[model samples]
Target: MGISKISEFDCIIFCVYAVEYRTVSGVAGPLVILEKVKGPKYQEIVNIRLGDGSTRRGQVLEVDGEKAVVQVFEGTSGIDNKYTTVQFTGEVLKTPVSIDMLGRIFNGSGKPIDNGPPILPEAYLDISGSSINPSERTYPEEMIQTGISTIDVMNSIARGQKIPLFSAAGLPHNEIAAQICRQAGLVKRLEKTTNLLEGGEEDNFAIVFAAMGVNMETAQFFKRDFEENGSMERVTLFLNLANDPTIERIITPRIALTTAEYLAYECGKHVLVILTDMSSYADALREVSAAREEVPGRRGYPGYMYTDLATIYERAGRIEGRKGSITQIPILTMPNDDITHPTPDLTGYITEGQIYIDRQLQNRQIYPPINVLPSLSRLMKSAIGEGMTRRDHADVSNQLYANYAIGKDVQAMKAVVGEEALSSEDLLYLEFLDKFERKFVAQGAYDTRNIFQSLDLAWTLLRIFPRELLHRIPAKTLDQFYSREAASH
Candidate 1:
């Protein structure tokens, strides 16, 4: 026995895991080389020394007997199989998840990172949580007013909806995300520093931000901004950077959503799950599918890509009985601004609506360069009203969308036949279009307007057009909407 122990510690051999018969020739992990068998599927389990100097459970994925493969519960990144010994615990893997984890941040593997004490173990839900039945879903009625004119008016965001922001490279999608997180909740109380709900709803609102494969600088920026803005108190951030393994990219969203599910469903909090840069997640799936040698789908995507996305999108909703609802805003970067790309196309089909970003607006130096015409929120109308905010809010939004859409078309036509050939009315539309983009769409620092100001500005611009041509608007709206120019005319 003594001789065998020494020889095994010093020897190197090939290993195959039990379940998949996966091989580990030079695969070094936290697990110490134990018994080696001929093939896989051994009921006998092995153990590994965890990073915390405590032991945890794992399975013998492959057994060559003395050189068996162990499927680690926690991944092996810094584990030194040389010194960190392995004792087969004879168990698979499990974690605790119950009512306690309301406001917590965890890694992909379900370990907390809030600098707090370890949680008391309880019933653990799989990090990849299950979705609610579609038949069980209630119709979405509440609108999520982003307070951005382009978004609030044109594409009205609704609560419990899965809305994705589609942007090209070099766009300020990150900035937009940060802005939403900052302004989304109520204002932070300056005097009541300890109070969690100074300006925002303390009991109901919380943000779950998951950054997959972003750089450290970007992660730090997001963390720092949330903290500085006081959104960090209620915000739970899960940061998975580029250096993390490819397998981690797949688990990142699942883990983030799991945390969100815990907070939203169990804790009774209105949850906002923001997944930035889904393209990274898709790439990881493609990598794994390629490794598995599976048949590829369109543009090398997996055949189950649509269903895979549905699994995530379906997680956002209001269950029939729960007061807490989970709303999701997934941000995806289009490849070369290709809307038809599988990532955006499949996403557009799955989600309730999409917030499309315009590169041309960025070229014009517009902050949050939202092209409102093409961008639409499927659930905006339910939230705004004279009682909700203003009576004119809906009408002004309709007019702005109508006029801007025309303006966009007219500008394109003018480009074909030089501006000289365009009619006077078309020229006015052209001027209105330019002014609309600059004044309303393009916003500067310290220039945030409430819903009222945004609607008022839209009316002011529409008044420039002849009132007779305003067939898109209700006559009641025209009679009630007071424009300074209209009074003068």
Candidate 2:
């Protein structure tokens, strides 16, 4: 049978070949090169039986006539080249998905790890998700309130948007990711502006959190935090440990996205997928590329790294006729705080916008530590307005950006020249910088603020300066929201 024809049939039925070959020629890293194999299709799952009775699972990476190369998911250690037997399943990797997956935990390869029973799957979907047609996409508009002031008020994440978090090594990105999982939801209505926190509705919202190459401590933190806060029931967690096989890391995100797509399209749930430390995923890709002896791109990463990332990020969006949508927040740590690193640099191109975590702000003990100047949400404007968030959102966001930019510049100048050299107005901006950082950007990790609370807090901070100083605000908006209470006090 032709391998291509076999693959087509494999998609319909479980194709398990009874023939087992002992023609394994060599083992290198995670790859097992088999010679004299017959018609093994690319990406077909295989069973590698060791000299012992145990069997390991693998996927065909390459096939040339009668020769095939397979990547073992459990890694290639202690396999006798002559005695090892390979069986081609003639099918690609697939995972069982169900709505019951909520609150369950799975490993990188979609195997249960939480001692839960097997999912009664409605369907088994290929982990390599199909690309969304561009013509079928609906623009992301509804806002997803994250409850963090910096993100909610400044870089707002829209539903169906793919926004990334750019962090440095040793930062609190995991904590932030967990916090978002706890507090994220869509606003039901702005019924009353007095207490904006009351408008959140998460009954239809679910989080698919996949942590790749994370340590035991970090994984436990995520699990414990979700459990203690009672948000685990609506979350589907996928964990890949630091010691997991490198090949598994490459598959972890695809499996997670497949589950997300199932939840969004099949079950009609608004799904938010958070992928932590994507740098680890890229590193795994580089390792696999090296084993395949492929040519490297920038910084030794695979040339197809960009294409690979696009497959992940592009899966998140609103389909034109679908009832539910998929939003993504991919967190990647830049090596040595370098924003220009291949990981963050290419991510910037694919994602809607990024929330940059500043090392300097973190050093100063600012929670979330967002460097607002560099952080942006390109879809923020479309999501927040008269009916969506608030009429004052655009003006307030712009004013905050303008004033903060000026305050940062003044603070930098003060550092270069002595503070005594500053003019009176300059010193006022310095004080604004301090208050803005402490009150606006910095908050307790568990402290959750809704969109109205965030905007009200912004107005409170803006009142520190005269109206003329807040030139970004329009005359009508200033007359309505601006209060002179701070100046009176």
**Relative to the true structure, how large is the alpha-carbon lDDT of every model?**
0.70, 0.90
Which run of 10 residues does model 1 get worst, by summed lDDT? 192-201
Q: Which predicted model would earn the best TM-score?
A: 2
Clashing pairs in 2: none
Model 2 per-residue lDDT tens digits across residues 1-489: 665545544556578647899998888888888989878999999998998778899999999999998999988887877778888888899999999999998998888899989889999999998888989999998899899999998998888999999998889999999999999999754554533445457978999999999999999999999999999999999999999898889899999999999999988889999998799999998998998899999999999999999999999999988888999999999998999999999999999999999999999999989999999999998788776788899899998888888898998898899898999889878888899999999999989998888888899898888888888899888887886652232
Candidate 1's residue-wise lDDT over 183-276, tens digit each?
6632221242322221223457888888887887888788778777776777777777777665566667876787778777788877889998
TM-score of each: 0.78, 0.94
Looking at model 1, how many pairs of residues clash?
Answer: 24
lDDT of model 1 at residue 485? 54
> Which segments of candidate 2 are over 4 A away from where they belong?
1-17, 189-199, 484-489
Displacement of residue 53 (Cα, Å) in model 1 is 9.5
